[model samples]
Target: MDEWFRSWGLLRDERQRTVFRRTDHTHLAAVCWPSCDADTLYDLARLAAVLMARDHEIDTAPPEQSISMARAFRSEVSARYGLGGGTGADPRWTPVFSELWHSLSTRRSPRFMDRCLATAPTEFLTGCLVYRRRSGNATEADELTAYFSTRRVTVAQRIDHLLAEASLGIELDDEVLGDPLMSRLLDLDVDRTILIQDILSAPRELAAGESENIVAVLSAALGCTTPRALEEATVLYENLTDTYEQALTALLGSPSGRDHDVRAFASALNDFSTGLIEWTSHSVRYTQAETSNWTKPDEIVARGR
Candidate 1:
């Protein structure tokens, strides 16, 4: 392993001995590359850990300190890439490494930060750390739990606020959580939800008149659907919206409303919901138990395209 990996405690040998649990989808990495060697995967894992730690640090840091630290990190990364005055390192790293670093380092841009935090490394790391606490080294796990608990809750609240603003929020109360079908909805990544919303909102901006094509590309990019949703993709999204809203209303013990566009955001996330379920079932970002009970529908038809 390289010094960076060792310094971050992501060494492959060490990981093998420990219960290195992880459950967040590195969507960018999956979309960009088909596969990688063990070393590359370990590097990505380590980088993920570091990025997640930095996320908590930035979120809890005072505004001035956060901004300053973000700029400094950005500058440091840019310098390594020869953007600022400094000698650049060898360009031997995999493309995923570079992409992940760019996403993690773009703290100055809220849009970029939103995208990163949407499927942030911290989310996955938090899941893993919690899993470890329940299954593996307690003392080590407690340290991680203590360090990240407050930060995780803070970030989650921020995300909840964003979801509310977007009208995509649902009360994750005992009633909702107790329902097996409803609770899985919480797994929906806020970043992906926003991306889907943006694409569905202004499809032409992304693909001119080929909104369906763009949706297919997005579905493929997200690893949500295979054989592409194609001509039926638009109809699928619409069906998803209506059905999702209905499901949400039922779960929330509320009635559906006429202003469907802004209420509960259930419809806006039909594609995302479907894709997340499909993707998470097989993705390494979730545990087998989490997906074991998932029942795939025999058919996924939408209204006539």
Candidate 2:
């Protein structure tokens, strides 16, 4: 471990070095590789090594073991940070957990995945901190009472930070948390029914030529007539469009029709869009193009010759 720390030290940013030396599992998880922080560190190390090789005129093999150690350290950090203390009865935390699960299951981008993986530590630490702060006078029977409280501002701030990190193209281990919109939604209080309703009413952009495919798929799965499937498909399509529009409106200031139940609307739209992508793929077509016999059959018109 000492040797490993020394190797990490050689790449020294003082904060990073401190993060390494303290061996705080939460901090380690926050900066682990493939996560944005890790990717940043990796790039910095590579650049430093390049300069050293060029200027110092020294030949050095890449520190493969050190890289591996960093990853291992990150894993340990996540485990420690995510334990969430001994109590598991926080009602406030329940919705957060649900959002986390939803983000994990729905979003599939590589960037999103990395963020999700990286979030283990942050979520765990935050949950524990909230629990400790709010659950001071809890009794056995009252264990079911709300033991966690998160201000909307704090949640929003964290979500913004994560989104900024993701937007900068930082590689994260879990793609779900890396998804900009999903991350934003997860930060909100799920009990805010009005917010939820608004989110679902937003518009989405179907990937090129994906609407037809999605329609066909739903038609098969629901075992409905083509007309009925088409109607349902249109509804689904509009919902998906609304989701993207809403997300874009929220994140990028695109205009959207105001929604009454923003949060549920957003959550439902996100969920459906996510499901549509998972169900439709490049290979899901119902028909294949017949191969053409363009090779000039045998002697290519000996009659013409």
Candidate 3:
């Protein structure tokens, strides 16, 4: 992974290299993208970097400059990739993107890529089929699940895993395990994650003067104190977890062959959801980086256990 960044010109210097190393994306990718082979991970890492360049607000640049940079980046990326029309992106992107685009086009046709870019672009770019979005912010849980599934991840490796394990056909392209019961299982899987992330990242986000978090949002919506909000959120997490386990139990206890494919897919999804919780619990991505010296990757990065 570090070699990819180094050779692709993404992490050009020692500081950037150090930061990339400490980020420890490899662990998370391995966990969440449970079905990814070496080639798939390579694609995921490369495209994830491109996506984060303008999407993730990592820099403390002034709002205006940041917006300007994002617009230029989007435009440049669109123009270069032929996603749509735009001009005058950062010149540095040209070489890196050209190589990426070349390799991508060699594997897949431009028209197919355009279609991929049009829908669930992140899944295609990242080459992971574990479908999710951090969109559990809703007054009700079921509503959030249905709403979020509309914009689900649509990559292919999860398909690969399912096909390999359950011997499923391409007819089941949709990632919901194709039923309401399976849908609820996934909703619970993601729901606890948002709650956990809300609790964990709330400190850093509050320090940065942000409150688009479950703890803060729930506090405001429920008219409760912060402690009450945290408590309620923890209860909700436990409840969701219990229900999800029950759902898994119900599925796994079936007589035989009733929902085998869905069960197999659910296992992979469990790996993804639970793996994310473990990885983030160990990583400092959501935590304040002040305590640890990030210059040392081994000290800071939460390696796979």
Candidate 4:
């Protein structure tokens, strides 16, 4: 069992190296085991998690003890398929098994785990078929093939259900992930450019309104309310405008900047300016908007009348 596991480990390392270099799926079919079903894939993932846990000192078990358990697990899987003891003899089979094992061991991110769970049964069954074939047990190949055909149909149905759920926005979460500012910036469409500009010039807009309270809010959000903050934002806006003008000048005078490119630059500048305007407009609104009433409503009404 020890020797079989060591051989499997070596095969996994080699397979990972080969798969890592390939850019397309052409090699995927070639590398997958004939009997590698989805269950086998799940088992492989579990094994990997166990190994990682042991390695990270999250699991208190000895290394040799873990290895023995892994060996036993592999043997049980082989026996369940009626393929009997130890690793198969085929060179190709070893590498395929190794690759699957290595992928499970290393890539433990949520996305990778989701993929592993989804495809494990098919991979394991296919791997088992491959193992049986390599062991010269061709008689059971037809049975394995029939089983895989049904499993494939089931998998296809499940995938369709998942797709429908995704399309319905069932998977969408309000919680922000990644860098919020960068994500917001990346998500900026032409229609949302004004909002972006407003965010960028918020401090300046608030200060211009003489709203010290609003200015403080903007300062807290931006992390720095230095005069340079407003100056830098103003300069960025001016630079963007100048870039557009420069392109236009070059297009008309020297035939240096392409007209089409200049048009795009102008459009971008318009977007920036529009955003700034929207932000400043909001600041003005907030400044003018009533937040408190020191005077009674009746007294103000009588004065107005």
- TM-score for each prediction? 0.27, 0.22, 0.61, 0.19
- Candidate 4's displacement at residue 87, Å, is 50
lDDT tens digits by residue: candidate 1, 1-305: 23443344432464322322333323322221213344344433445444544444544455455555444444434443333334433232223245454533432244433433343333433443343333333232223224334233323323332222222222323343345444434433333343343333333333432221334344544555523433344554556456555555654553322334324443434433454444344433233332223223332213211
lDDT of each: 0.38, 0.33, 0.51, 0.33
Write model 4 residue lDDT over 202-305, tens digit each, in one string: 55446564221222333344567555445544554456445545544544343322334333432333333342243233332223322211333344334322
RMSD of each: 18.1, 21.3, 8.0, 26.7
Give the number of the best model, judged by TM-score.
Answer: 3
* Residue 130 lDDT, candidate 4, scale 0-100: 39
Residues 1-305, candidate 3, lDDT per residue (tens digit)? 65765676655567656655666766656555556667555655565555544344323345455545545544454455433443236655656665555555555555534433433343432311111112212233223333234323321232223222221221223444445565565556555556666676776776685545666666666778878977877887788778878977876665421555555566666656555565556556667762222223343224322
Model 2, residue 168: displacement in angstroms? Answer: 6.6
- Model 3: how far is 125 from its true place, Å? 14
> Least accurate stretch of 10 residues (summed lDDT) in model 4?
25-34
Clash pairs detected, candidate 3: none
lDDT-superior candidate, 2 or 3: 3
Q: Arrange candidates by TM-score, highest first: which order?
A: 3, 1, 2, 4
Instruction: Return the candidate ranking by lDDT, descending.
Output: 3, 1, 4, 2
